[model samples]
Target: MEETRSQVDWLTRAVEALPDEMTFDAMQQLILSMVFLRQVSDVPEGEAQGRPTWEELVGQVAGKPDLVHQPVQRALRAWSGSYGKFRIDLDNEAVLGQMRSDSRVVDRALRDLIALLDRAGRAGAKGDLYDQCLARFSEDRVGGDYYTPRDVVRTMVGLMAPAPGDEVYDPACGSAGLLTEAARYVETHGGRPADRTGPVLRLFGQDINARTRSIAAMNLILHGLEDTLPRDIGTDNSLLHGSDAGEKYSVVLANPPFSMRMPLTDAGFVFWRYGPPPKSKADLAWVQHVLGALKADGRAAILLPNGAAFRGGAERRIRAGLLYDDVVAAVIQLPSGLFSHTRVPACLWVFSKSKRAHAATRVLFINAQDTGVQVSRGRRTLTGADAERIASTFNSWSKHDAADVPGWCRTVALEEVEAADFDLQPARYVAPVAAETAPGEDERRVRELTEELYEHFAEASRLEHELRDVLGT
Candidate 1:
């Protein structure tokens, strides 16, 4: 924990050292790319002996402050040849060229950052540090697009429960948080071979954004995953284009962009089975793409907007198709504000191609809407305990010790789902159960409720007067 704090402090100082003209996007690229370069320098086989490593480059910068770009670019190119290209393009004028004349500024920042990382060593809490960078960017409201809060990533990973030898894929890999967490899950659970030559789990990921994919690559490298699984991340549009022909995975985890619109013609690949999702919303499109990407007997945990669970029209039909096929496994509604910069209520949809006999005919609905602890005025996050409880409930149900905990979780059969016109929203099925409370607590609740009621009554009275005046009555 202390290591994590120190790393964040180092990152703050590094960011502070940068020039004010650097946009968040450029700063992100610059910092993350340098970090990646620093890591790659440790591997001896990347280039012939004479080429300068990260340390050498930092030393070289002290003499000729203007000479940072070319050396870094050359090292990046040579290493990329030995260990496949990471696409952290130094040649991109937008990133480094904007400050080429003021190269001393950029060089100084890199020197300071690399010095901190070097002192921290190879095993520094780099993944957490990278995530902190992403979170800080999200707080600034510029990076929420690709940053999935780490807690949310952990919850999704726990549900998937990735194992050794599982082919895990994330269609919308983002920062590759879900993929890396899955790798860590396997490591924590202990099945990796002592003499492991290749990855214990085959991890693959695809994202539409190149810069995000670069971040994902750097993240994987920082986790030491590149040693076993080099260049596993790609820039494929999982929805518009299919993965390398006929490829499939045993586990798929994703938090795809919510409420994204797509051209109907572009999304026709997965439409034959699930039908085309509405152009205004690609929520179900992502779900179907993941389902299609799964191998028989595969399972997935996907996060989507709450509306996808109960929304009408094309999404409704798609939900019906998923339910009828017995592929929809569970829907866990998370609290609103769980994401940093957005207030969109999200839910996790666990899908299975082949369910065990116990969960084969039913879908588990978990009402974890009230489960998170507030971390800030507007942001909430699930604790480790909260995530474990949700994972255990689903795992127990899958293993046949199914119990319907009132207001929290319930395994509803296909018939009950059909009876409700296939509304998979947890609240629609799991009614809130009041908990036993102390007398003082109950009194406080009653007072709060009374105040809320009066507030509603006052609003209703104001609206009535406004209506009367508009009608001249």
Candidate 2:
């Protein structure tokens, strides 16, 4: 791991050394594109025998400095056909033209990147390099919607418990984090290996940002999932556009952009059957989309702002519809500051198409708002133990063994939820653990408090009587 970090750091420095004219977005694309091109060109020894490697191209650039941009562009375009096309503009001479004066710097950066990858060798296929690059860049970017923290993704994946042969989908798959985490979770739990030999689970994702969608493709490729069809991981607006109505998956995981306002005109009315979400807020719109995209027995996990749990009007109607359907399985309220971009408290809404007989009429509420440990000034994450605790509580409930733990988790029947007017905030229902007291200790404490109060009352009366006598008429 240290070695990988060292490599990433060196490559990051190379990117940093570029001319000032290059934007962060351009620089990011340049670095990732180069890394991806190198990985693709490295088609093993004796394979793709005639194809020029990134190393050979860079070596030739030293002799013919003027030809620096063309060869690399051609190479990337050539390799893109076999892998996937990058969405950024490589032909934009305005950016590439600016490098003419700093050709040597560009050449050195490319060479250094190639050397780093050469040292990385076959391990580059594992994607740690790319993952770290995306993370490092994302940390400094403004709105961090493009990257979901790995720990959060892990917790969601752990709770969902996807298995082999299950079709998995992420509607707002920023950099494909959720899908990759799900793949990793399956591998960790003794399912099929996440290799090129056809992944055990069929993974699918869609992102609206073309550049981000491209990044998702590279992410999947590096994780030994290059064989996934292009159509499966697309750039369509998932809310308004999706697979045919008959198409659905057994597992879905998503962390869509929060509080985004977009036109709902393109979306089918079927998705809004329960109610149309307000144009100013699309949180519940995303919820209904996920619910509609599930198979008959599908299970899903979604990360949304806390407001979705108790918002009024149309949102409440949707919540009621979901409850009546008995599909809302669990709502685990997460800690605040879990995201760097926003401090809006978030929660995980787990849905099940077919619930067990014991849990069908009930919904599990886990008040984990106080569960995580602070990792930095304003960021917190769930430790493995934290994640396990949440998952175990849900597991226990699924097996009909759930017992309410004050201030933590509770199992509420449909009737109780209705009585509460469909308020799903776990804190409103899960009581805090009462303070422990010894036998008869409560009575003794109350008696002592009562005597103290009586003494104060007597003092007040005596003072009033003395004042009245002094002012007597």
Q: Could you tell me the TM-score of candidate 1?
A: 0.83
Candidate 1 local lDDT, 1-473, one digit each (tens) = 12256556666776777777777788777777666666666545456466667667666656666655666666666555334435445443457665536667766665666677565445555565565666666676633777788788888889988887788888888888888888888888875512266546877888888778777887876676664443456666777876544478899999989888874568337534778888899999899889888999899999999899888898889988998899988999898768865567999999999888888778999999988898765567888899999998888887775878998998899999988887989999888788777779978868866976686699689989999999999
Quote each prediction's TM-score: 0.83, 0.81
Best by lDDT: 1
Query: Alpha-carbon error at 19 in model 1, in Å?
Result: 1.1
lDDT of 2 by residue, 339-429 (tens): 8677689989999988999898799999887777876655677877888888888877876757778789888999999998999988888
**CA RMSD of each candidate after superposition:** 6.7, 12.9
